[model samples]
Target chain A: MKSQGGDPDEELVVRVGRGDPAAIQALMARKLPRMLQLARRMLDDAIEAEDVTQELFLRAWKQAPSWQPGVARFDTWLHRVAVNLCYDRLRRRRETLMAEPPEQADLGPAPDRGLQARDTGRRVEAALAALPDRQREAVVLCHYQELSNIDAAALMSVSVEALESLLSRARRALRAALADMRE
Target chain B: MGMMDRTRFEALAEAFGGRIDLWPDAEREAAWRFVAEQGETARALLADAASLDEQLQELRPPQPSAALRQAILDAAPRLRAGRSRLWRWLTGAGLGAGLAAACAAGVLAGAVSTGPSADATADALMAASDDGAALGPVESLGSVDTESNS
Candidate 1:
């Protein structure tokens, strides 16, 4: 993955701490989509994803004032926050089986190859959501979010070797679940 | 380093993707060597993983709604402002009695100001104070009494 140079959000976070509106806009543009993607993939629900994203930003606003710079990249910290929030919801889901079933996934219609892609995508998502939470988190972080193994491990708070183990298991499960996708 | 073997190579392909470039640097050369020596078998393993990768790629998130973005942007300032405003309100309530006590004890000078803002603030502060006697003098001094003046 390409580096974006030094932390761009350091100064913006300071400004956001002071409640600068432009800083909020800048942060949103830079962070919101990726956060939304992580949340949606983790929760497999758009509404919950939106709530998690909103709650994440609300936290950023609250934390900005006391934010200590250089400890970590703001983006990494934000992703960690998103993952934690998703875990909380996932835990709640397990505790109370009555949580609304995951929203109906809409695989948009596109021509031929696009249609196949959508069908495969839907299957992949269902298989992903079916995995145990930790395994699902490992795959989402490394595969979908494209975090390098090292960073993904750090975010998941596991040793690098442990992360690879998780990835291996996740892939095995996915490969089995998605076997039908193969000709 | 030992020559890359099929089982380990397959595991690498499964754990990462078909793309040797994405494999960890330490393993990439070994993986490449394995692919070179066992071209068809290596390719087959990678092809399986690549199929999964392709579907993973297809799992693109729906385009985030404009409203969601706007709502988040709109919310940032409000959460911040709301927090600070709540702090001010809480401080006023908690300190209402202390402030009144200070005025009664003659620890601080009192300023009498008239306006809707002062009236509302005084009413809130007075409401929050537990001791009516201590607040009596403070209110008499700060109360804007807009109702009669208006």
Candidate 2:
């Protein structure tokens, strides 16, 4: 657990093992916003988003004892957790929608970007969100999480070909969403 | 849907991926040709898929929050501290229980001994006392007669 600082993530993790408060603070200072951002996008509610983000890190901190090098990268694990939490929140929203047909689905903070960028990003999110949860997940891991297609497909618990099909549909959906250009 | 042939799909996917935003025109065009030859269905699907991919490419990864990085670092130590506390409690309980068990067993054996109770108790005590010595916790039968015979 010596802080050789050779690897940033590893070094911080080592510091954390040594009970360094600074490392913990340093970690939060870095990851909280992105976690929150991811949470917000997935949940579409800032408060719940923030909550998920906090919970993700809290679990991460609590699991440091058995932290190992090769299982999955810590960041990847956190992103996975965030993704799962988002799904959980989405399920609840679906239930709520079913229960009260009049209530609107609160799609979270719309990303602020250029006209093309914003439109494309939203179209993609909507397209992705429309797919079956697993397929959507495959697309999210590959495109949003920046995981390799193989890795994303594996994470979705599906064959790579199945994942490619999912990706194909996700792409088709996005094109439909954007290319249609109808209100 | 079921996959196309593995090799064909791989080749198509490989070609399709190469044109991802910025790649050499010839390579990308070649990849496009491979896709088109796969049939109209493939071409149409990929055109749509590629456009959507181009759209998705717009949703950039945002700059992570200051809080996020800190949360990660903070969580690691907090988890370690929690585990550390649990371990301390477990080790302390184990040591205490082991000592209590040993005392109970020694007393029971001593009290319930045959005619040579005191000698047996002395031997057991010596064994426990020398637990951390050079021999490292081996019980000695203390039979010189046996050694000499050997």
Top candidate by DockQ = 1
What digit string (tens of lDDT, one per residue) describes model 1 on residues A1-183?
332456778988877775555566667777887889899888887788888888998888778888777767788889889999999987786665545554544332222322333477777777777778888898888887888788899899899788888989998898897777677
Mark the 10 consecutive residues where model 2 chain A has the least summed lDDT. A107-116
What local distance difference test score does each model get? 0.70, 0.53
Model 2, range A98-131, lDDT digits (tens) per residue? 7877543443344432224445556555555556
Q: Report the error of model 1 at residue A22, Å.
A: 3.8
Candidate 2 positional error at A182, Å: 13
Clash-forming residue pairs, model 1: none
After best superposition, candidate 2 residue B128: deviation in angstroms? Answer: 40
Against the native complex, each candidate's DockQ, computed on alpha carbons, is 0.18, 0.15
Q: Residues B1-150, candidate 2, lDDT per residue (tens digit)?
A: 233453654444432332433222224455445555677655654554455456667665555555644444433442221222222233345445455456546654765574366767655544444232222111121211111111
Chain B TM-score of all predictions, in order? Answer: 0.45, 0.27
TM-score of 2: 0.53
Candidate 1 chain A minimal-lDDT segment of 10 residues: A107-116
Candidate 1 lDDT, B28-140, residue by residue in tens: 88888898999999999999888878867878775678767766655564323222222333334554544534543341123234334655655554544432221122112
